[model samples]
Target: MKAAVANTFDSILKIEDIAKPKIEPHQILVKIHACGVCHTDLHACHGDWPVKPTLPLIPGHEGVGEVVEVGSAVTHIKNGDRVGIPWLYSACGHCEYCLSGRESLCLSQENAGYSVNGGYAEYCAAHADYVVKVPEGLNYVDAAPLFCAGVTTYKALKVSEAKPGDWVAIFGIGGLGHLAVQYAIAMGLRVVAVDTGNAKRELAMSLGAEYYLDFKTDDIVADIISKTSGVHASVCTAVSKVGFRQSYDVVRRGGKCVLVGLPPEDMPLPIFNTVLNGVSVVGSIVGTRKDLEECLEFVARGKVKAIIEEKKLEDINEIFADMEKGEITGRIVVSI
Candidate 1:
C-alpha cells in the first residue's frame, strides 16, 4: 500500500510503499476512499502535539471508506459496509470515564493518526466497536471531515446547554468554525461569527450566521453584546491565547465557554476575570461513536454540509504547506 509517511518533524511527507496491515480478530480492514486533513494532523507533523508521533507515521483520522474485509470476531460490520473512522478510536471499556459514557476522556485511550497508523493510505484497520456507519446518502469525501469537525462542534454545542433563540458565538470562522455556524443555525440558535478577515465573515454569513464580525476591524466584545444582548455561550474553535481571552469578555455572566481546540501546553488563562464574570470554562474533545452517527444523520438530511477542497494523495506535502499558512478555508479532503 502507498501512504504519505511523515519521516521527521517540520518536514515534507514522503510517499512510500508499506506492507498492508492484516486485520486483527477485533478489527476490520477498510479500503480508504477519502481522508480529511485536519489542523491536528499538521500539529502532529510539526511536533506541536504533546506526544511525539512515531517517525514515518501516517497522520489522518477523519476517514471514510468501505469495509473490504472483516476479522473473524467482527459481526456488527460486514463486507461492503461504509464506515467513518474518527479520532476517538477505542478506549478501555472498564475505565471510570468510559463507564460513565465519557469515553473521550478515558485515561487509557488510543488515538487514530496520532498513536497509531491512520488513514493517509490506501487501506487502514479500525476496531469494529468504534467505527461509525456512514449513511448511504452522504458522499465519502464530504463525510470524511464530519468524523472530526462535525462531531466536535456538535458535541461542544450540546455541552453548552443553550436552547433555541439563545445567542451562540463562534470564535474563528475557519474549518471548525464554519461547521459550528451551520450546526448552530440548524439547532435554532442565533449565531455570531467572529474572525479577522472579510472573506471569512462573508463565508459565515452565507452559511446562515445571524451576524458576522471581523475581529480585526470591529470591537467584537461590544458588537456581540449590543446585537444579542449578551452571548449565552461561546465556542472557541481557534486555540490562540487572544481568542480564548476574547471569548471570556463577550459571553454574559454565568454563560458557558467551551474550548475545542488543542492549544499549547503553556497557554495561560485569565483566571481572575473569568472568576469575576461567573463564567464556566469547559474543555471538549472528540466525541463518541454515537455523536459521529448523529452528525452523519444531520448531513444526510441536508441540515449541514462540510465545505471541502479535494486533492490527490500525492499532494499531501503541498496541502500541509498551505494549511500551515492559513491559506485554506473549510476543510481539505484528500482522495486516497
Candidate 2:
C-alpha cells in the first residue's frame, strides 16, 4: 500500500510504500477512494496539540470508501458497503459519557489519525462498529468532508440551541464555516457570516447567509448587534484569538456561544458580563456516530453540500502548506 507517512513532527510527509494494515477481529478493511484534508491533519503532523499524535502517522480522519473486507466478528457491516472512517474511531461503550450519548467525551476513546493510523492511503483498517455508512447518493469526494467538517459544524449548531428564525453568526468562512452557513440556513436560522476578504464574503452570501461582515474592514460585533440586537447564538470556527472573543461578545442575553476551532490560545471570558447576561460558553468537539448519520442525511437530501477541491494523493504536502498559509478555500479531498 502507498501512504503519506509523517515520521517526525514539523517534517514533510513522504510518500512511501508500506505494508497494508491487517484487521483485528473487530476491525474491517476499507479501500480508501477519497479522503478530505483538514487543518487538524496539519496540526497532527506538526504535534501542535498538548495530546500529541503518535509518530510515523498517516493523518486523515475524513476517509470514505468501499469496505473491501469485514472482520469475523462484524455482522452489521459487510463487504461492498460504502462507509466513512471518521475522527471518533472507537470508544468504551460502557463509559458514563458513551452511555449518556456523549461518546466523544469518553475517557477511553481512540481517534482516527491521532491515536491510531487513519485513512490516508490506498487501504486502511477501521473499527467496524465506528465506521458510518455513506449515503448511496453522495459522491465519494463530497461525502469525505462530511465525515469531519460537515459533522463537526452541524453538531456545533445543534449544541448552540438556537431555534428556527433565531440569529446565528458563523465565524471564519473557511472549510468549516462555509458548511456551517448552509446548515444554519437549512435549519431555519438567519446566518451572519463573519470573515475578511471579498472572496469569503461572496462565498458566504452564495451559501444563503443573511449577512456577511468583513472583520478586517467592518466592525463585526457592532454590525451584528445593531442588526439583530446580538445573535441568539454564535458558532466560532475561526482559529484566531480575536475571533473567539468577538464570538463571545456578539451573543444576545441568555444566548450561548459554541467554540469549534482549535486555536492555539486560551479564550478569556468576561466573568461579570457572562454572569449578568446568563450566557453559556461551550466547547464542541467532533460529532458522535448518531450525529454523523443525521448530518449526512442532510447532505443526501440536498439540504447541505460541501464545497470541495479535489486533488491527487501526491499533492498532500502542497495542501498542508496551503492550509498553514490560510490560502485554501472550502475543503480539499485527496483522491486515493
Candidate 3:
C-alpha cells in the first residue's frame, strides 16, 4: 500500500510503499476512499502537541471508506459497509468513563493518527467498535470531514445547553467554525460569527449567521451584547488566547462558554470574572460513537452540511501549508 508517511518533525510527509496492515480479530480492513486534512494533523507534523508520534506515522483520522474485510469476531458490521473512522480509535471498555457511556473521556484511549497508523493511505485498519456507519447518500469525500470537524462542533453545541432563538456566538470562521454556524442555525439558535475581515464575514452570513462581527475592526463584546441582548452561549472554535478571553465578556451572566480548539499549553483564563458572573467555561473533546451517529443523522436529514475543499492525496503537504497559514476555508478532504 502507498501512504504519505510523517518521517520527522517540521518536515513534509513522504509518500512510500509499505506492507499492508493486518487486522486483529476485533478490527476491520477498510479500503480508504478519502481522508480529511485536519489542524491536528498539521500540529502533529510540527510537533505542537505533547505526544511525539512514532516516526513514519500516517497522520489522518477523519477517514471514510468501504469495508473490504472484517475480522472473524466482528459481527455488527460486515463487508461492503461504508464507515467513517475518527480520532478515538479504541477505548478500554471497562474504564469508568466507558462504563458510563462517555467513552470519549476514557483514561485508556488510543487515538487513530496520534497513537497508531491512520488514514492518508490506500487502505487502513480500524477497530470495528468505534467505526461509524456513513449514510447511504453521502459520498466518501463529503463524509470525511464529518468524522472530526463536524462531530467536534456538533458535540460542543450539544453541551452548550442553548435553546431555540437563543444567541450562540461562534468565534472564528474557519473550518470548524463554519460548521458550528450551520449547526447552530439548524438547531434554531440565532448565530453571531466573530472573525476578522470582510471575506469571513460574508462567508459566515451566507451560511445563515444572523450577524457577523469583524473582530479586528469592531468592538465584538459590545456588538454581541447589543445584538442578542447578551449571548446565551459561545463556542470558541479558533484557538487564540485573546478570543478565549473575549467570549467571557459577550456571554450573559451564568451563560456557558465552551472551548473546542486546542490552545497553547500555558494559556490562562480570567478566573476572577468567570467565578463572579457564575459563567461556566467548559472543555470538550471529540465526540463519542453516539455523538458521531447523531451528527451523521443531522447530515442525512439536511439539518447540517460540511463545506469542504477536495484535493488529491499527493497534495497533502501543500494542503497542510495552506491550513497552517489560514489560507484554506472550510475542511480539506484528500481523495485517496
Q: For each candidate, give its TM-score against the true structure.
A: 0.97, 0.99, 0.97
lDDT of 2 at 298: 96
Which candidate gets the maximum TM-score versus the true structure?
2
Model 1 lDDT at residue 306:
87
Give each model's whole-structure lDDT. Answer: 0.89, 0.95, 0.90
Residues 286-336, model 3: lDDT tens digits: 899999998888898888888888999999989988887879988999998
CA lDDT, candidate 1, residue 117 = 83
Q: What's the lDDT for residue 213 in model 2?
A: 95
Where is model 3 more than 4 Å wrong at Cα? 265-267
Q: lDDT rank, highest first? A: 2, 3, 1
Compose the digit string of candidate 1's lDDT tens values, residues 6-38.
Answer: 999998889999999898999999999999999
Q: Indicate the TM-score of model 1.
A: 0.97
Better of 1 and 2 by TM-score: 2
Winner by lDDT:
2
What are the clashing pairs of model 1? none
1 or 2, greater by lDDT? 2
